[model samples]
Target: MLKEFRDFIAKGNVLDMAIGVVMASAFTSIVNSMVSDIIMPFVEAALGSTDFTSIVVKVAGITFRIGNFMQAVFTFLIISIVLFFVMKAVASLKNRFTHEEEEEEEEVDPTEALLTEIRDLLREEKQSASK
Candidate 1:
């Protein structure tokens, strides 16, 4: 059981997943910074200093931070678009690497073809004799 566990942990897929998780976490920070620090400022300037993060509403007893929700939505959209393009590029690269041009079928060996013809001719002769 210990050896099996060790083998599982040692697999390339597990290591790759770990690395991916770490890189994704780092990438998330970069994306978040880009959205909050860069994009939001430009957006705020265009919208006359409107802070979407602070926009909220209260109804009955519940407080709804709609601005934060909008920010989150924008963040998701940016991330999704970036990921979509990245995946598209990776897919194209994978297709390029894995694509195999079809090759014309090789001619059958003469001896094999002759034997097949002879077998067919014998079968035909047998069928005729039986008839």
Candidate 2:
């Protein structure tokens, strides 16, 4: 059981997930800051409100915080757009690196290729001679 647990923890998928969680937590803070500090000011200015979160509605014996919900939705949209661009950049970089690796793998030494063909021909000739 201890060995199994160790193996599980040592697996690449587990490590990658742990790293992703940590990075996501950090990324969330950055996105949250961008939304609140940078984007929210512009949004509030456009809406003619000093504080978006303060905008609320009152109903019959009830209170509704529509502004807060809207703020959350706006933050979600900004984060989604930022994440979309980030993921696209990462995918392009990954593809570029993989493409370079494939190109390197495809490049064969001309001398080695010639030697290989010669070896194959010699083998065929030897087989015919034996026959």
RMSD of each: 6.5, 3.5
TM-score of 2: 0.72
Off by over 4 Å in 2: 1-14, 34-51, 123-131
Q: Which ten residues in a row have the lowest lDDT in candidate 2?
A: 47-56
In the range 16-92, model 1's lDDT, one tens digit per residue, is 99999999899888777866786667767887764568988999999999999987787688667766776899999
Candidate 2 C-alpha lDDT tens digits along 21-130: 99989988887787778876887788776445886899996889988997777767877887788789999999999999999999999999999999999999999999
Candidate 2 lDDT score at position 123: 100
lDDT of each: 0.81, 0.86
The residue ranges of model 1 lying beyond 4 angstroms of the native Cα positions read 85-131
